[model samples]
Target chain A: MKAPSLQNTLLVTGLFTASFAQAAELEITVENLTRGIAFTPILIAAHDMESHLFVTGEMASTELQAMAEGGDISGLEMVATSVAADMATNPAGGLLMPAMSTTTMLSTEQMNTQLSLVAMLLPTNDGFVGLDSWTIPETPGTYSVYLNAYDAGTEANDEVRGSGTPGEAGMPVPPPLENVIGMNGTGVAASITNDKVHIHPGNIGDAEIDGGSSDIQNTVHRWLNPVAKVTVVVSE
Target chain B: MTIRLLRMSVATALLIMLAACSDDNDDSVTEVPEEPEMRTFEVSVFNLSANQPLSPIAVIASDGGMLWHTGEAASDGLEALAEGGDNSVLIGADSTLGSTSGDAPLGAGESEMLTLSLEAGSETSISVASMLVNTNDAFSGITGVDLTTWAVGETKTYLPAVYDAGTEENTEMAGTIPGPADGGEGVSEGREALDAVTMHSGVVTADDGLPDSVLDSSHRFANPVMKIIISRVE
Candidate 1:
């Protein structure tokens, strides 16, 4: 009986060491590739395979809505903690400007093998750049992934000045964006057409600044797909 | 306890034998210097836009030269190719080890394949470019794509982004475009608002309030205007 018990203890210890061997240190850099748009505080997390920050064609969770609509990540942080995910929040310290980049280091646990990131696009209602769950490669190397803008589908992209609350109808004009955005706009859309998260139909802003259908500038604020670039280096 | 001890000894002996076998195999497989050989690559470009006709495709393989860089002034060769649909200057560049050009303009939803061959010893890279002939200087391409590790039969696909040459403004005027939209002149020597290359902020057609534009809603396009597939055939 004593011999069997000792062998069991050895087996458990071996398994524990093997699981710790799978741990990895990751250096992640997120770059805002747009020429004019800015990204709100970014949330980078390494969670389990089943977890996701936001999924396309699926209704967004309330936490995703807060981040997409108001650039708030507190709710997401709580969710991450509940799932035992490794996360680095607000690595940019503030809004990441156009053509600027931010880097963060994340030490991931054995089960946390997937990565995700999200940040709101200022001057647009409920529009956020997102990376759904991407499986982290087991090999030690550098990899890059491009991100696209997605609409939370919780608010109308009215393109007018309004609140950032989840159910708002207009864009949140942060101080840095105040001078660049136009005013006295009628509004672009009245209701959400797609009730699930979907790829953003690029902003249809007008050239008129004082009065137009949208308060966003057509030439300055418009962007194509792949608005952000995320590079991840996996190291043991 | 005696059985466990015997089992551990057998496992250690097996591990040592496995290590010895691997070492012997490594010694037998010595590294050999690679000889310079002619390598052939097939590049295919597909137009994915609604009404934008792609200029004749230019495919080039070189050591490490880039056709154009963002935030930098366009090269004279790049300027002529972007403004006009003529790829002669780029195809005839000094840095290109091998180059090829499509026979004619590729219409929307059409594709063209061209082949290039280069002697391979040093690191090699490929570049591909084509102009959206309806616009002023909008072009889509991929530059400095490494082909060092690509297998002979392996193929890769890319959705390239559009760029503005900045040599000519996107006026969308009657005599500014070179395609069927306007049968206008090509390659003006004027430098306008921005003299450096940048990602194209899409064309604002006449239906979108650009009253002077000769383009209509059909001319508008989004990102990833072209699909490129590269394969090493030889």
Candidate 2:
């Protein structure tokens, strides 16, 4: 270790109580790293270990179905409030555009030690980006986490123009997606193969423009895992 | 003991120099400029895909520029290289501080090494990119990999994810791909796909689905397409 000089004081002040004693002022940045898929209204919450936005290999809850089917975070917000979770809803204010990024704050309470996030992937059936109950690091400088796309298994991926209502088969087309998404499609998948929530097999788009099996362009709507990148700058 | 002897010699020299300076009142000063050191790195890349022949690797060390960023449109140089497997533009582009390319195209299960040299002082970030010649605009690379803490004799390796340069459509049509598997044209001018670069949704060859595809099951590929091993040799 170096001597406790003026340089040491500056270093100490620069890296304050970043370790986990709880009650941290966290500055979280969410990056929509995908090329063509837009994220509908992201929701980030800091809760105890008991709370989870969505669990893999489990049936989708009615509240989670509503958010994954549509772009509604209201139901999830109410659930977080009931759980006494420190939450930040709709951090991007609206649809987080492809390749864009947004930042939000979560001044976590002592009891809320785990972080979770959820957002819908536009132009898809029941697809969402999820971070399920990741333990908030106590000793933190800057932490980077990559998130993958998941299927809610609540609706079949018809890949056609339909309603945003829960239990719907078609994808909800926001105004921003009206001009972008194609129209008059036959269907991609007839039913959800995996009844339980699982990793998305990704969209299988086609090249036909006027009419095709799927409305999604093969070149545009498809993506790989780890679609979004989340960076958390945790401080005292 | 060495410090004491060195201190006595320096004191005697300083006394003699002070006497000389006082006697002459000289104002002249001499300065010797220091030479800047250069660092060299050897990057060996292995094409790990099924049959996609990788284009000549582009190895660059930069300060802050990104060779290719996800969600952004690929530059003209990147589009040319991704589409045609030609690296002339990316090597001479203004974005790189120092760059080099492999001697030849690396085939499937083949490996090649290229040496790159850069001036010191800047916290250099290494960027490596190569095209999967059989697919339309499919490239694999690492952008802004920090090499600031690297020392001589240290080696680092990475398995990079594949990317779809959203510049050309992945139609698998005839005369679209530039690799020997297709023997089609290269570097055609157009932006037909989504305007943003994204993760490569694996190719749907003819055996899998796409009826008009020039490719077959042998042309299909997945992520972590290339294995890159970088060593600081200097």
Candidate 3:
């Protein structure tokens, strides 16, 4: 026990140090790919594997419904804070417009290895772009994930101008996007037929920009899956 | 037995020397000879349609560049592929490394495998494309997927979602669709009513209230219209 060999100590310590250096730092970038859609202030969280901000086919929680229906992230922010997640709120400082992107650096504080992002799609009743918990890779490389649009299932897709409060009747077209929306359009539909969170049937815009069944422009407002492209670079 | 032991010891020493030589070579690549090497990948594509038959597949290996981007207008080559399912122009278009096409069209519930081999170190990304021939200008595939993570003999499968080329309108008219459903026009010259590309709203057939549409409800489709798998075979 008293052999006091220096090389063995240095080797063991070096191995431990190398293991510590292997932890990854990620650079995350999110792009809004819609032609006319606007994303509300986004919320990105790095949390444990056991938690999820939103899940499909389940009833939307009060917090998620609040964000999806009204483009408000306060309730969801409170939830992420409750779990003590490494979170970034409103990286774009406001709405992320079509074809625009925002980047942020995420530092994972050990055991927090999953990433999730959420933002309400503007000019919709209750649609949002979502990237559910994706595992952060341990290897150093660039990874890309595309996000799809989801219905919050809390309100009917009336596709008209209305309130930003939860349980509202129509979509909230914020001030900057207000002028582009149409006027004098009868509501698209009036019933909350599907009550569970599911894939959005997509917006049904009409040919008449001045007076259509929906306020959103069919040519400019329609979108496909992968509404947002996210690029993540992991660094050792 | 002594000779066998000698050979074993020689092999062990050679392996150690080789490992050391590789590490040194990593630092001094100037002495290494540069030779042309070939990298190959096989693209397995599946048609996930009820009735809409896809055109022959077109696979291209290119640099980390995009063949097309959403919210932008389509190039002439992409316009040709979207309108008619004729990949002749796209296969030879710009931003291409190497391209391969299927022998025949893929019908409903069918599959096709096309092998695309590229010269090693020539390209960093792969783009696969094909047309949903029954629609006006809808196509589905992947673009600019980096290949550094892929290795020889490893496979990666991708389920592709449909995209509107934004070159032609989704008119669904009788003489507009190029597939057997219409046997109509392919690659009409001119501009579309809307020039920007977006997610396809899907085919609105006569059953869905588009009376002039020659297509039926069977032509309808959802997000992921095709399934694709790529393996670096060599």
Candidate 2 residue spans exceeding 4 A from truth: A1-21, B1-208, B211-234
Query: The CA-based lDDT of model 2 is what?
Result: 0.82
Estimate how well candidate 2 is docked, as a DockQ score.
0.02
Q: What share of the reference contacts survives in each candidate?
A: 0.05, 0.00, 0.02
Clashes of 1: 0
TM-score of each candidate structure, all chains considered together: 0.52, 0.50, 0.53
* lDDT digits (tens) for residues B202-222 of candidate 3: 888764468899976446666
**lDDT per residue (tens digit) for residues A124-214 in model 2:** 8888998988778887689999887877878877788898899767989999999878888887767654555555657766776557777
Residue A52 of model 1 has an lDDT of 86
lDDT tens digits by residue: candidate 1, B1-234: 222354477579989999988877454676888967877787877676656788999997877878899999988878888889888998788888778988899876556667778786768789999888989998999999988887798888887888999999899999999988898878986787779999998888774688999986446666666778788877
Candidate 3 chain B: 10-residue stretch with minimal lDDT: B1-10
* DockQ agreement of candidate 3 with the native complex: 0.03
Q: Model 1, residue B146: what's the lDDT?
A: 88
- Whose DockQ is greatest here? 1
- All candidates in order of TM-score, best leading: 3, 1, 2
Q: Measured with DockQ on alpha carbons, how good is candidate 1?
A: 0.04
Task: Write the residue-wise lDDT of candidate 2 on B1-234 in tens digits.
Answer: 222354477579989999988888657886858867888887877675556788999998877678888999998988988999887788787767888988788876556677788877777898999999998889999988887788999988776888999989998888999987688988887896586789998888774478889986446664566778888877
lDDT of 1 at A58: 56
